[model samples]
Target: MRKNLRVAAYAICVRDDRILLARSPAADGTPEWVLPGGGMEHGEDPYDTVVREVEEETGYHVEVTALLGVNSLRRTFPGRLLRRPTDHHGVRLLYEARIVGGDLRNEVNGSTDLAAWQDLDAVTGLRRIPLVDAGLRLWRERPAGGRVQPP
Candidate 1:
């Protein structure tokens, strides 16, 4: 068996009641909307990670406005036929951000295939990763401890 951990940053960029989002390929190779951010590099700060990821994934330069909250998730899955089971843990840092520059464009040669603004009211009806819901809760509620029970 193997254990793996991922610590990544995500942004909640809301403007005019629409949130900026990126559609990345999910585990089953289908597209699902997510906040525009990803894992930090070896020596990068979480703040820098959010800015860089937002640009790479959404072609938008962002300024991280606030540390929204954190969401942690864990899963254990069977590996390929001959391999052992693996434990995966993901810790996501959600930040509130504002777009500073750049245009809306889909990521090229990256995990995400599309980038677009989705209306806040219609988000619940979309097929999305749980992080989207969790991040939004953190953004709206602004809990004192900056933590939420991810859905």
Candidate 2:
């Protein structure tokens, strides 16, 4: 099996009682909601990655405020492009961000299809990526170590 490791960053942008989210384009199957960010480019700072990704996905210029936390997950799944079962590990840096400028809009010809601000309380009803919940947890209870505490 092929092994793959991905390093990425995500933004947790909340205003009023809503949270910004991006609807990922259907790839593995059903489209899922995700935080507005993606894998880091070669030698790119995670902070820069977050800023660029947010604009690409949500059409919003954002300023990353604080480092929230990190979350990692590993899984085995069939690859979309390679068409083979593969082992994948994803390391994600979550950051608190604020929209500084630009108008809200959906991404075009990107990994994500749409962007929207969802009611925080209504998020539970959406088919979302696990990172959304993990990021929210980190945002709400900021641990000193910048890591999620196991229950």
Candidate 3:
């Protein structure tokens, strides 16, 4: 079996009855909403990954409160991808976080199309990254222990 290990972090930031989300540009330049965060750097702690990503994407310092859960998925790179498909896999670490400080400004180097607070109820109508569903599922189970580990 071909196995690939990747590490990424994501933050679920809730503020004043709304969630802070970043709208990222899709492969074709269309906008798709997603939580603000990104891949872990060499030797960087996962916790710090989320913090650093949040700042880079939204210019906001965030305080991670707890681990939401881990999401592992098997996926193949698009055939047109220049990289090898054997190297494709997703290992994401999602966390629940709160904004600490800094003004909400989009980073010039960011891949985000837009950044703004969206009403919780209206999120269903927006296009979201796949991980958002997993993150929200874990968030809903906040006090119920956590995702049942595979037996």
Model 1 lDDT per residue over 1-151, tens place: 7998989999999999999999988888888898899998898999999999999999999988999888998999898988889999999999999999999898999989999999999999998998999999999999999998654
> How high is the CA lDDT of each candidate model?
0.92, 0.93, 0.82
Off-target runs (Cα >4 Å) in candidate 2 are: 26-28, 78-84, 149-151
- lDDT of each residue in 1-151, candidate 3, tens digit only: 3457788999989777788899898878788999899889999999999999999888899999999888787766544446544655788888999988998987676678567889888888998877776777787676355553432
lDDT of 3: 0.82
Give me the displacement of residue 30 in model 2, in angstroms. 2.1
Q: TM-score rank, highest first?
A: 1, 2, 3
Q: Root-mean-square deviation of each candidate, in angstroms?
A: 1.1, 2.0, 3.0
Worst 10 residues of 1 by lDDT: 142-151
The residue-by-residue lDDT of candidate 2 on 32-141, one tens digit each, is 99999999999999999999999999999999999998999999987678587889999999999999999999999999889999999999899997789989999999
C-alpha lDDT of candidate 2 relative to the true structure: 0.93
Predicted structure 3: clash tally? 0
Residue runs of model 3 more than 4 Å from their true location after superposition:
1-4, 81-83, 143-145, 148-151
Worst 10 residues of 3 by lDDT: 142-151
Model 1 quality (TM-score): 0.96
Question: How do all models score by TM-score?
Answer: 0.96, 0.91, 0.87
The global Cα lDDT (0 to 1) of model 1 is: 0.92
